[model samples]
Target: MTPPAPNIDPLTTPLERERVLAAYQRACAALEAAQQPNGAWAGEVVWNPMLICQYVICSHIVGREIPEPRKQRIRLSLELQRKRDGGWGMHPDVPPAPGDHDHHPNHDRDPAGLAGAHDSWMFHTVLGYVALRLLGADPNEPLLQDVRAWIHAHGGPYGVPTWGRAWLALLGLYPWSELQPLLPELWLLGDDSPMHPRRLYCHMRLIYLGLSYLYGARTQADASPLVEAIRGELYPEGWDVSRFRATRDQIASTDLYEPIGQSLEWLFAGARALSRAIPAVVRRRALARAWEHIEFEFASTNWVCLSPVNGMLFCLAMWSRDRRDPRLAQALQGLEYWMWEDDSEGLRICGARSDIWDTSFALQALCEGPQIDEAARAVDRASAWLPRAQLRADILGGREHYRESARGGWGFANEHHPWPVSDCTAEALEALLHAEHRGWDHAAARLDLSDKLAAVEFVLLRQNDDGGFGSYEPRRGSMLLARFNPAEMYGNCMLEYSYTECTASCVRGLAVALEALGANMPSELRARVQAGVDAGVQFLLGSQASNGAWPGFWGVNYTYGTFFSVAGLLAAGLDGEHVAVRRAVRHLISAQRDDGGWGERYEGVLESRERPLDADQPSRIVQTAWALLTLQQAAPERGREAIERGLRFLLDQQQPDGTWPHDAAVGVFFNTAVLDYRLYKLVFPTWALSRWLSR
Candidate 1:
């Protein structure tokens, strides 16, 4: 049976206790109200306007017309994300500084006035201008005029980065010959070859799989007046392909996160020369091999591919081969799974769906809160939905296709989305364990013992030799492979290295399952779980920095990493007196803002270190919740005052309707794109407060 909820803290004043309970009630209500009809609590996975731009460009390449209504909505979305400098940025506008309530007002004003914001990538600006034009916006319109001037001032379209160049070249607005090559012949490399595409990270390799195929075919849309007009507009100076081709290596300063190094340049030159030397017969064979992989990817994910970025690329590749292929239509329809439409952002395709990820976390939060009885029906629905969302079988011929086994795991989005991630599986297993331990009424919906063991085995398989876990697969390529990284807009994307968050989640999940399974577990599985937990703990201990913070690869910064690390350690049976736990507690204590909350800037992600946000900067609800959750587990007695203050901050920040503000980006990836998960504000804080009350 589940343990009883802890008594209300004796030290809390009567008035404070009343406030806490009221706030808790409201937050629970808000969460319950937000549940979707399918029993999931999916938030919009907000990203940049680049997705909209790509969608428009892709529709043009495939000869699909955008309906007038959808086009207007896309235009509105572009207008909303435009910066004060009359350019589109790589991510949404950063929230304003403290005491600036109207910073992001509900009007045309650019709140941050961040004209030169780091997020103002030249690639996004170029895509935005072209997308607006394709959507039928007048060139002489004031917004278009301002955007055009911004483009010219930023060195025009020639300065766009490698991927941007590829997109433009595909649309016949730029020259393909001058762009850096993505050789499909690389796919012909043996499985054992170190440089094989299969050795790269799953997302990176899948994207290039489509890109290499298109590059080999020299795929370009048929020339149209729209393409010609956009071409002239992009290069206002002139459309001299040879003159602009010289600037192929010249990326805009704003968009260069990882410069193409000297070694990569040599490799590119060699690849260009090799492309010319390869026999025509060999080239045809390589393209056929590349197409085999593309077809396998489409079959694996039911034609969704991996992400919208690659999803678009694969659609273009399919059209180039055989426009009448029925699978091309299926692949195009699968892209709709990632789309999110709303009055505010209009019709935008998300980078990925968060249904399973969001629902798993939300379930755990509800189970932890004192109001579980009120949320019982919601819990029952979510609990029932989670098991259905689990990937029940491995992808057939997964090894041949370079896929890790997905059986007993959950993908980030939903079951049909076949790329199951380590952290997502761990978190989902932990949530189910919480529900089962509570003896929830949905008995028939519960996963069987075999299912639970399969999940544990799945996570166990993801553990690297170093004892840490990677996101999708074990580390396949060397860190030295990073030198060959071609995606300038991203970082650490060439290989799947072990991440602190993934390791911590796996540790905690395995620990909980070990206890929950009790005598029903097999002895062999138990031994493996114990060994995995011990090694994972050692990895966490070894990875902690001198200041006791761990770098967060998935979330905003150190606060996220430290929170998961501390929780994992405690769950692995470490006490508050453990040196790692104490150091982590102290780190959180030092980072606490004067207002009693916590905040971290996205810039810290770029620095690959924990640079605490300035004290005067606005604190974030999600970070504050993370801090409170960590402090309560790791230093409840030593950091009592800090805990109480954090609780108060959360309580005060709660709105009359029960939710806290999503003040900043909480999720991050590739050290660049910052993500705003909309449900984060409601989920984390409610979890924190519930734990505080229970404690």
Candidate 2:
């Protein structure tokens, strides 16, 4: 029933090629102008307002000197992000129309009537309220009072989420017994047990280790007058603390992204009872074991820990274990590595650094447009840095620390970032291989063949049984882990699942690595790599949605998934005329705007739902780049005109300073929270332009 697809050739007339090359030069020049002297291109990682508050509380707790200017910056961020009723939510709003910082005072008098009322979780609200008080805001300040009143309306600290309860208990505002027992003995679970800690997603497992130690030790901060004062403000009418244990399982409605089912609740209750009966010596051994694992994490990442969420919790736990510990001091100092400041948002934490991730893609994209002789210095610097950044050794304490083989894999952030993600590793390998295939002399930069082979092996180990790949390691836990997920503000926090984006990254990486190795590669290793690529290609073919779009795990939605899927298929030798490739090409063309741009809203990705293409939404530079690049890979012959139009859209949108205006969010996590990767605009558009010019 589908009409025969239009026939077209990507080969441009002389005039068209000239226009494409001009755009390519402009884009590359823009990136070069923006590149820093440090040999890295860093971009802002837009995160939630809760990060600002977490930094405030953690700095105060650790006795680190919080500069007055930084304090004011955090205050401004909270004030600007505040809802009409004086509350904060999961994400900040787009900036007030350029240059109009009127601070709209009279928006909504009733905090309950705010537009995103459900978006404000008790966890964030409680932290924000406390952070304000710590910054010397009066208890009776009208804004403070309104936020406090809202908290009570939502069941106060008693109804905070699981992580919030742990924090409040650590602050001495809540009783230790009120928390569900997170005993370290769980680490003793056999590998065959479904509940083994190693089976959890890397982030979740590491967070639990720190949390269980503090909980099992009944650790609480020393009593302070400020803590005592905030306690009164939070629970103003409190009388009997006896019922705290009874309310441990209670969660606020606003926080319920994933509800705890009855089975898990009953299981938790029985666990709590058993925890009370645990022998003191046995508990000591478990807590000691937990502390050692904590030490291993601190050593692995040089105290950056995985993400800021676990980083903050680990800071608190280490302080509890040994206040004078030098590791604790280093952890506090390293926190600044992820701290980002903006005039509008003030201060917040990044989800992770994007140095290697951004640079790898930048180099690979540049190879498509810029000659090695033209971007020589830039390419040499990046290539030199890439070798150093690759994980040359597995993490220390591999078995005891519950880490996977990381040698030659790339991390999401930087070398110091402990987690080696499958997609990040694949992208790193692909970038290096592509650069070499395009005549980059890796030997000139001292990068040897062994380095390339190790990267190939890393990807081979990460492919799942389905031929897809997960973010961190191969899948170890079942989806059934979701039932016990107590972090209600987010979904899919319990385990890592195979992702289309990750699978595609591996396919592309393997294909390029094999090409670069050629006959020089050992026959056995080449055979293994070839088989892996074949399986990955099948996975992509079978995973396509009926509508021809693929769902993305790490990016905004289907557009992101389809972009990677089509690119991987092309790299694996699928022809543009192939039915699957044609279907994908048609699917993307359907979403193109009249202006020849593409825009994908973050709402569908956040809600895990399908969205119709609507011209009503403004065009996004990032999505446009993704769509353009996919078209270039899947159907360049019939896609030249479309690609040209898209190129014009990007050129028109770029700022004179070489950056594109920040578009809609470019990334998402936990299926609900949205974050931004600021450099996506520059890197992807440049990549898209280069692809068109190459054709």
Q: Which candidate is the best by lDDT?
A: 1
The TM-score leader among the candidates is 1
List ranges where model 1 is wrong by over 4 Å: 1-4, 95-119
What ranges in model 2 sit over 4 Å off?
A: 1-20, 83-85, 92-119, 242-247, 342-345, 372-376, 440-443, 613-615
Give each model's whole-structure lDDT.
Answer: 0.84, 0.76
Clashing pairs in 2: 8-637, 10-637
Clashing pairs in 1: none
Model 2 per-residue lDDT tens digits across residues 1-695: 01112222345577766665666666677777666665556677776678768777777777776787888778776776665444666644333211223543322222111233354667788988988888778889777888898898888888888887777787787887878778788876677898888889888898898888889888787788988999998887773567686777678887767877898888888888889898999888888888888777777888787888788877877887788987777878768778888676677778778888888788878866647344556666677677677888888778667788988788888766767877788887777666666556356564578878888888888888888888888888877887888677788878877788999988888887787678878999999988998999999999898888888778878889999998888888888998988998888888788887986665667566656445455577888999998997777668867877888888788776556776566687887677778788889988887776655
Task: Give the per-residue Cα lDDT of candidate 2 at 182.
Answer: 83
TM-score of each: 0.96, 0.91
Residue range 560-625, candidate 1, lDDT tens digits: 999899888888999999988898999899888999999877778888766666555667789999
Q: Lowest-lDDT window of 10 residues in candidate 2?
A: 1-10
